[model samples]
Target: MDRQAPRAGFTDVDRESDPRFYIRCLDAQHASAFKQRYKRRTFDLLELRPGQRVLDVGCGTGQDALALAAAVAPDGRVVGLDFSRTMIDEARGRSRGKALPVAFVRGDVHHLAFADDAFDRCRADRTFQHLPEPRQALAEMVRVTAPGGIVLIVEPDHESRLFDSPYPDVSRRFFAFRNSSLRQPGVAHQLYALFKEFGLTEVAVEPLTEIATEYASIAHVAQFEGGMRIAQRYGVVTEEEADAWLAHLAEADRTGRFFHAFTYFITTGRKPA
Candidate 1:
């Protein structure tokens, strides 16, 4: 099956739908060393300690949950929550017979099942952008975390996505259409202010850039061709223009000028004691 979904894939996940496509995109991104560097940074920012319970919201395939479980060893535990049953099942299957201190549950981020001060730390990676109410989700994340506990958020600024191409005008239109499909493509750029609004102290933000030098390296994850198909479908760009943009990207790769980069913001804050 084609790994790319017909539309932007992250905001939807179901067994009757394209679980494989969504999972493939995640796996590809996680497999990249460039992506792994930032993933590790999140771990460091969380400052995982022994015997400190943690919560991972929108925990997709559970790779980060497993790692978090390992980080908080011995008496500590990690709760992985997602809205998709398929994702929960996939997570459970991977964790079966493993000695990791983690559990997967299906839950809504806007209304987390956990109570106040339930966790020593809370985090959501690449989650807020898909949420219609990112503030509510952040409130819940902050509420569950105990005083002095960390609340970390990771998201990409979609407007920051840049692909070196000849058609700059068409590229802007294409990205505009693409960003419109997301619930909040600019969520990453808003976290600092949101944290302040929620009374989270010591707020900090770090911007990391993920650059793809090869067409094949990013096409599967970014859905280069599949996205163009949708763009043309929506009349955001004409067929000839979209095709030309794609061809320009390909030629850039052959000429060693290919460049695709997106900026990810890692924002973290501490709930006041």
Candidate 2:
């Protein structure tokens, strides 16, 4: 696959066009201990049963799909789909040498290539924020799931992101700049209502919170740098201001005062029988 140009800023870039960067971000997310814990909670909420058919939309590198395969072992199967062929290729590569019932395909969530009621369960994680039409994606997920089957959606409310810094103005500018890049920075908080509006039953929402007192624990090293660079690019902050803000964060980390917290919502509903 041909490599795409490096992103000029944090503004929405087609992840499919930059597979390497997308893969790196996925790797960083997998390496975070807090993120792993949250994923486990999501899996538990899925309540997988043996011999079930599952679909993981925007499965990325198949980490979660592999786990889902293990849960539905023996007779069950999982089909991991992504719009990026590179991501699908990476997911297939990762599944090698494992005797699991998992398959990867390149496809779009807005127009799933599956028959109605084709899956026992369906899920999409951290994907809705980037979509300009999240409701359409949710409708497709619901359409593909069997009646009484579950459809799970997980997404972060970027507007709720918070970081501890002495310079309140800088922090505000940083978050505003970051949120501007997302199509729906506050979609997670609206998922429950969306599900209900789509006529799904038993809709429920849960907030998964992460509090990082240490800079490393928050996995903000790259994020901080990226946000500042984007802020500067978008004229939200000056280069000098960005540098000073980063310096303050570094000092806080060294002094054991660094803090960050964000909450993501996991919303699930069942197709009416």
Candidate 3:
């Protein structure tokens, strides 16, 4: 069977105008749990101090940015930047009533609207996979960060995804479809080398792995329906096969046998002073 080209899901539309699609994916309860699990780890790596300026590129909905704002409170500032105006608006709306010193802006990562060495710290989470020119974005991140500032890049290695489905072939097809949909599905593995290439010092890469045993969490991670839809659309799997695959998962969830796992690379580097 020939695998079909993966259809663009959230990446297909202009997120600036259609932020709902992206918001829906990240607003799920399981998605929050997944984020909480890693946010602390990422923050610890940042070593943020009071009164330092921080920038969160591709700050979707401002969750991390809000957290950073709280960490840098009393005098510090945190700015959340995204290319999608609607996303920025949603982020700002979420910030209402909060006295956090965080600002949301619509801007491109490749051309940050900030002066060189303007921020004490910079980070982008799960953003590079969707970017066609992730290297350029990383360069901009390096450029805007002040000397000795930390730059953290956290991204998932989609090729490392694993699922315990009854139909291994269908699962394989689904994985294939999922990986093909990403702009740089394997960018996480390249973070270390990219940091070195950008002349960053004290580069470190940490792999954060997560396993989802419950249906809700697994569904959020696998994007089960979306993956099957893409597989069916591309002829990677028959509609019947896709249905059967989902049924197997549903049965596993009911039987307390559901399993899914993936790894994300959290790479951090310090800009040379």
Candidate 4:
């Protein structure tokens, strides 16, 4: 793959039309930590097996894709897709020289470049939230899945992150970001509804929860702080305000007054046999 020319701004205006800005979260090392925290949750939701074909939408660095590749060893295939060229490059590099056979491509999740009923099982982890039209994406996931195949959409419900923190400002700032990104998790409950709306059958919804005790070890906290810094760096937020928010979160953790928890909704449905 050729190196795409970098744009001037941090975020791409095309993100509203294209799924490019999500790479901000995907191309970071912190994503690996978050993936670990939710590994069991995602795997339980997938319920994959050998000789099965899987498609991992918004595969990021392809860690989840690699895991699926291992599950379908020898016979099964796993294809990972991301909209960002940088992420696809990293993903390809990650699977380089690996015995497992996997394919990584730069493509939009909302508009996948595949024929109908192409994959046995389709998954979009933490991808729908970034979508402007999540229901359309959900429908597409089901469309690309073979009949009787499973389509699973997994995401964190930000509303479930209410922690009883001693520092009020910590929760406040966190909630600001959460509230801004509210649309991402808002569709969690609607995923099943969308699945049914798209004529899928045997639909089901599952919830997974995890708690973080320490801030330093907490991936979400780190991600929040880094994102805030990015916003500051890009003039989205003032540096002083970002510093105050960071101080609050750090202080909350140091004083052992921090409490953090996230709930993930895994909604799955199967096409008619």
Off by over 4 Å in 1: 1-7
139, model 1: CA deviation in Å?
0.7
Residue-level lDDT tens digits of model 4 in 107-157: 877788899999988988877776767877776787789998888888777
Which is better, 1 or 2, measured by lDDT? 1
TM-score of each: 0.94, 0.90, 0.91, 0.76
Worst ten in a row by lDDT for model 2: 1-10
lDDT (0 to 1) per candidate: 0.88, 0.84, 0.85, 0.72
Question: Which residue pairs clash in candidate 1?
Answer: none
| Model 4 global lDDT (CA atoms, 0 to 1) | 0.72
Residue pairs in clash, model 4: 129-184
Whole-model alpha-carbon lDDT for candidate 2: 0.84
* Candidate 3 Cα lDDT to native: 0.85
Model 3 TM-score, all chains together: 0.91
Model 4 misplaced stretches (Cα beyond 4 Å): 1-34, 166-174, 181-183, 219-252
- In the range 163-255, model 3's lDDT, one tens digit per residue, is 897799888767877787678889999989999999999999998888888878656546788768777887888889988998988899999
If ranked by lDDT, best first, what sequence of candidates would result?
A: 1, 3, 2, 4
Worst 10 residues of 4 by lDDT: 1-10
How would you encode candidate 2's per-residue C-alpha lDDT over 1-273 as one tens digit per residue? 212223332123244456578777788788987679878888988899999999998898899999999999989999998877777889999999999999999888989999999999999888788777889999899999999999999987778888888888989877876676567789999999999998999899999887888887654434687768767877788899999999999998999988888898999998999
Clashing pairs in 2: none
Specify the poorest-scoring 10-residue window by lDDT in model 1: 1-10
Q: Which residue ranges in model 3 land beyond 4 Å of their true spot?
A: 1-18, 29-31
